[model samples]
Target: LLLSVPDSTTGTISVTGLNGASNPSFLGMFTTIAGFEPAGANFNNHYPMQDNVSDFHLYDIGEFFPIQPVADYNAETGIILPPNPNLSGQLKEYQIEFDGFEQVHVDVFGLVTSQNGPNIRTA
Candidate 1:
């Protein structure tokens, strides 16, 4: 049976299974062109996992050197910041699972200037 589902560009996606099941088995794969994947994965690895600024740390210091706003930063600091110069990164994609549903989030993170450049001293 075909299930009718809404087209939500950046939100959760829910679909009904053949047996009226809400959480259907799902398999997903991600592929990227030559250098894009590494670039993205690298960015993702550096991307800040914490959403709080106070959660950032650099060698025992519980604050990002020179300090930065969470709304403007994407990666963790003091871990060999990328030399992208001008400081930049992308969202690539993300997955969220809840209430028997998995939502894939994809969007560009755009761009923001880094308070501390990749060469900025963090001591």
Candidate 2:
């Protein structure tokens, strides 16, 4: 599996075999805030596990709608609080899993930029 994050909000994940590795039977991805961990965080999203007509098995995060928080209301004061803050600067965690492989290898590469000029990489 190879993961690439070109920007803060968009990414592409690709899974492929090495020389003669067989195709996996399943593929899943799970994502959550880094500091704010959630329950059952593994493999929450599943993708179709089949041979693509094209040469790549890829999933794009931009194709899905962003997750939104529910509204919070104060019963006593009759006021609604604002939604959560944006994801900027906050760390995020992504987990990828698959089946039908005796062994698996994973690699991640990313380039993040901010208003200040600096490049960052994480493992």
lDDT (Cα) of model 1: 0.27
**TM-scores of all candidate predictions against the true structure:** 0.16, 0.21
70-103 per-residue lDDT for model 2 (tens digits) = 3465899999766655422222234555443333
Worst lDDT run of 10 residues, candidate 2, spans 48-57
Local distance difference test scores for all models: 0.27, 0.34
Give the Å error, residue 65, model 1: 14
Task: Report per-prediction Cα RMSD to one decimal.
Answer: 18.6, 16.6
Colliding residue pairs in candidate 1: none
Clash pairs, model 2 backbone = none
Give per-residue CA lDDT, model 1, range 1-123, as digits (tens): 111112222223433333322333332221212212323333343222222211111111112234332224445663543345455432111232324223322232222224565653321
Runs in model 2 lying further than 4 Å from the true structure: 1-89, 112-123
Q: Give the lDDT of residue 8 in candidate 2.
A: 27
